[model samples]
Each structure stands twice: as C-alpha cells, then as structure tokens.
Target: MVNSIKCLLLLSLAFVPFCHCKKEQGVNLYPQFYDQSCPKAQEIVKSIVAKAFAKDPRMAASLLRLHFHDCFVKGCDGSVLLDSSGTIISEKRSNPNRNSARGFEVIDEIKSAIEKECPHTVSCADILAIAARDSTVLTGGPSWGVPLGRRDSLGASLSGSNQNIPAPNNTFQTILTKFKLKGLDIVDLVALSGSHTIGDSRCTSFRQRLYNQTGNGKADFTLDQSYAAKLRTQCPRSGGDQNLFVLDFVTPVKFDNNYFKNLLAFKGLLSSDEILLTDNKESEDLVKKYAERNDLFFEQFAKSMVKMGNITPLTGSRGEIRRICRRINN
Candidate 1:
C-alpha cells in the first residue's frame, strides 16, 4: 500500500507543473467574464464612449489607438494609463506616445461610471478593451466581442514602449519585426494598420517624407507629388509640427478600406502608410486585397484586434485591479 501511494503521489506531482502552465498560457479571458460580476459593465462603457464620439467623431479613433498603445507596451494591462510615480516610468512619455496619444479623460469617465455600479470590481485594463470595441462599432467599423478579466500591471515599461512600438519612419522590415516580437504576423500588421483609416497624424510624423527622402533635400518620390504639394500648404518645411492631417482623406471619419485605396494611389499620408505598398510585396498584395474588398478588411481587422488584445495579459491573481487608471492601487 505504501509503494502504491508513493507512485500515485509522484504522478500527481508530475501533472502539477502542466496544470500551472496551462493556466498561465491559457489566460482564460472570455466575453462573459464580467457578465455576472458587473452585468452593466459593457453598457456603461458603450454609453459614455458613444457620447464622446457624438461630441467629436475623432474621439473614437483616439480611444481605439489608446488600447493599441496600451497593449503594445505592456500587454493590455493598463500600464499606458499610469502616470509617472515612484519606481514607475510612464509609457505616456514614450516617443510613440508623448503628445500623440489621447482619450484618457474618456477612460476616466468610464471608470467612474463602472465604479459607481461595481466599485473595485471592474479593471481599467478590461475597460480599455471594451472601450476599444465600442469605439470601432461607433465609427462604423467591425466589432468583436472583447475578452475580459485583464488585470492592471503594477508597473509600466517606458523602454518597452519606446523600443517595441513601431515608429512612423520605421522601415517595413523593422515594423514587421516589431509586430512579430508581440507574436503578430504580416496579416495582423497590415489588418491592424487599417485602423489608420480613421485617425489623424501630426505634420511632424511625416514631415521627413515631405522635405527629404534618403537625407537628400528632396521630397520622397514615392509620395504622390500633387498630394505632397497640397500637404505642404499646411505642413510646411518649418513649423506646424503639430498641424493635424486626416489619415484617410477619402473617408476620414469612417473606418473603411479607403486607407488602402489611398495607398494604391500613392496618396498615403505617412511613410509607414506608403511602405505597405512600396516595401514588401506580401503586404502590398494584402493592402490591395483590402482596398478591393471592404468585407475582407473588416473581418481580418476584427480578428487582429482580438489577437492584439490577448498579448501577455495578467489574469487570475497576477496583477491588481487598479482603482484609478493613472495610478496603481495602494
């Protein structure tokens, strides 16, 4: 009997690591995670986001990009929401963020509403995911059920934000490599790039292309010359770094395939945007396919968003549910 029990104990111990591995890797987030805990969570986020979008349709794009910036730096744990504090450097100060990222106030409003209904129950990380989905739906883009139960990171990674997030001037290979580091591929990269269809970019983000290509004092020949001339009116060689330009002039406020369409015409606003066509044949083909088929682009975009949201989430007891998004819970 002692020998039999010893053998059983060893077998059970062998399975322990496997079970833990499954839990860690599985993450186990689902659409219904908040269904019972806070039944009104999704409704609260949607209503507030809809109100914000009504006031300024661009707000939808800002909220969507907020989630992207959050996930890319620290795996959708709301680290991007954190302000600089003891032992924590804010990702907001990162190059890709700085003056570019917005929509923090909207998130705060959503958190306030959720706290009223279920105090300390809903996490800011999950709030960001839901808000992103609501933003997409509000802007006539594809909608996907956001998996919930993401916990907030106790610390933020400023270096990760700088190194991991792809820059507008990054070469196509570099951008693809950055996405790959986050477990994304060419399809996800191109499809997620479709989000640019709705947002605006500052003049500084693309001024290099307008004034100099290859460090030569000449405009990038790859850009549509006429389009560049029109851009130069607002985005001059000097000053106007903060000047805003709609990413997709065709359908700026709507999330559509017009971004890809503009790319095909060489009217893409950012070097990053034009590179989809200029740099790699595979991405170019995908861009053309998306431009030709709105449904295909929408479908892939939804899937890619979901995949992006699932990046290295802190679930179970891994991280805290932050009371205030801008600061870690005491």
Candidate 2:
C-alpha cells in the first residue's frame, strides 16, 4: 500500500508541470497580464491617449484605425509600427498606409511613458490594443477589457499591408473576402467597418465616385447628388487629392451609427462604405439594423473590436516586448 501511494504521488507531480506547460505554450493573453509585472501599464497608455485626443479630437479615430491596420497585416504583432531599417521595409509606405495611416507619434509618446514606468516590460502590441479601447470610450463608444501580453514583431510586411488591408475602392466581395481570410465573418466586417464613424478619408480615396465610378464620365448614382456636389467643391477633379473629408458627416467626431444612417441615405463617403447598403443583402440588413439601434451597434462594435484584437498574437517568448514602438529592440 505504501509503495502504490508513492507511485501515484509521482504520477500526479509529473502531471502538474505538464498542465502548467500547456498553459504557457498556448495563447496566453488576458486583461490582467501586467497586473503584477507592471500594474500601471494600462493606466499609462490611457493617459497618453487622452492627452493626444484632447490635443486633436480626430486623433482618437486615427489611433483606432492604426490598431485595425496593424492587426490585419501581421496579426496585431506591431509590425505596422516598425520603421524602415537594415532589412525591414516599413508598412507605413504601403498603398493603404502611405499618406493615410497616422498616430505613430502618439504611440511613441505612450511607449516612452510605459518604458519609464517599466522598461522593456509592456509590449507595443498591447499598447495599441489598450489605446484603441480608450479612444473608442473617449469618443462616446462602448469599451471592452482588452486582453494584453501580445509581443512585437521583429519585422514589417509591406506586401501584407498592401494586400491584406482593404482599399477604399475595393469591391464589396473583395473587402468581405479580406476579412474572411482573417477569420472574420460578414457580421464582423460590417461592425468593424463602423470605425468609419469617427475617421476622415482623403478626397482621392473616393473622388472617382464623384466623377467616374465605373471608368465612365457619369457619377456614381448610388451617392446622393447633393452630398456629391458638396464633396466636389472641396475634393475637385484636379488638385485636391490630399484634402480631407469626414467619413461620417453627421457625427464627424463622434463614434455613432450615423455612418450607417448616411449609408441608408446614400451618402456614404467611400465605395466600400456604400457597398454595405448596395451590394450584399446580408450586409444591407446589418446596416439597417445598426442604424435603427445604436445600442446594438455599440454592443456588436465592442465585441468585433475585441475579436479583431485577438488575431494571431506572438506571446510566450515568441516575440519581444519592443522598447521603442518604432524599432526592434537591440
């Protein structure tokens, strides 16, 4: 009886380490990841984001989009933050990002604050996720507890940025396919695209719709003529490619369902935005549902943002906690 008990004890002891190892090996992201390592990590990120938002209200939108762009390309690994270096070509120069993607300076500010508190402790990927949540809440949107402990990538992927991130001109099917490839469904696509509720788009992004949507001289009939006229005044045909237009004219700086309402009225700013109403029946129903119920939109938007943030993350010794958001650790 004593010999049998000793063997059972050994077996149980061996199983304990195996269970612990399984957890360490699995994707181990959670909201309290830094509770012990750096109790103030989320606080530091939120304070910096709030400062940026106060300085420029539009910054909230810019920061939110930065997170989305990062996740789509390299699975929220902070590859989007990498600057061009020895062998790394930054995604910042990609077609989708070139003159559009902003908020890097704000991220740098947050990273500096975090490093001062706990050097080399918090990951840039986690910082972006937290900032995104704070930005949404600051802009009157619903918030969620962001899972932390994501690690930064050692490199960037310009090709992935260009190919994976949907363009303003991409067809409805193309955009849906891009999201689907990322393990997102049609509901996720519509909910995530609601980020347009607070951002701005370059005139060049949708100027084709104002003039020639189908390679012809006619304007896109799907757009409201009066809205198109207002856009044409600022966007013009010739030299206003860089001029900015609010994505949601009704609630330009607020995170709300007015983006979907505008789509219902045929006033969505980009072809991609309008297609949710015009192209697919399922998407159109979602747009109508969200437009009618702000609570539903907010609920789904929060859930979808959390889902987007969970895309293939590097954790458990796979990647480093970048000291500076813009460069790999030395």
lDDT of each: 0.93, 0.93
TM-scores for the candidates: 0.92, 0.92
- Candidate 1 lDDT at 6 equals 100
lDDT of 2 by residue, 1-330 (tens): 999999999999999999999986767888999999999988888898999999999999999989999999989999999999999999999999999889999999999988999899999999999999999999999999898889999999999999999999999999999999988999999999998999899988998998884555567999999989889889887788889999999999999999999999999999999999999999999999999999999999999988898899998889898989899987
Which segments of candidate 1 are over 4 A away from where they belong?
Answer: 1-24, 213-217
Q: Write the per-residue lDDT of candidate 1 for residues 170-266, one digit (tens) a residue.
A: 9999999989989999999999999999989999999998888565557787899899999999998889989999999999999899999999999
TM-score of 1: 0.92
* Span of 10 residues, lowest total lDDT, candidate 2: 210-219
Model 2 spans > 4 angstroms off: 1-26, 213-217
Q: How many residue pairs clash in each candidate?
A: 0, 0
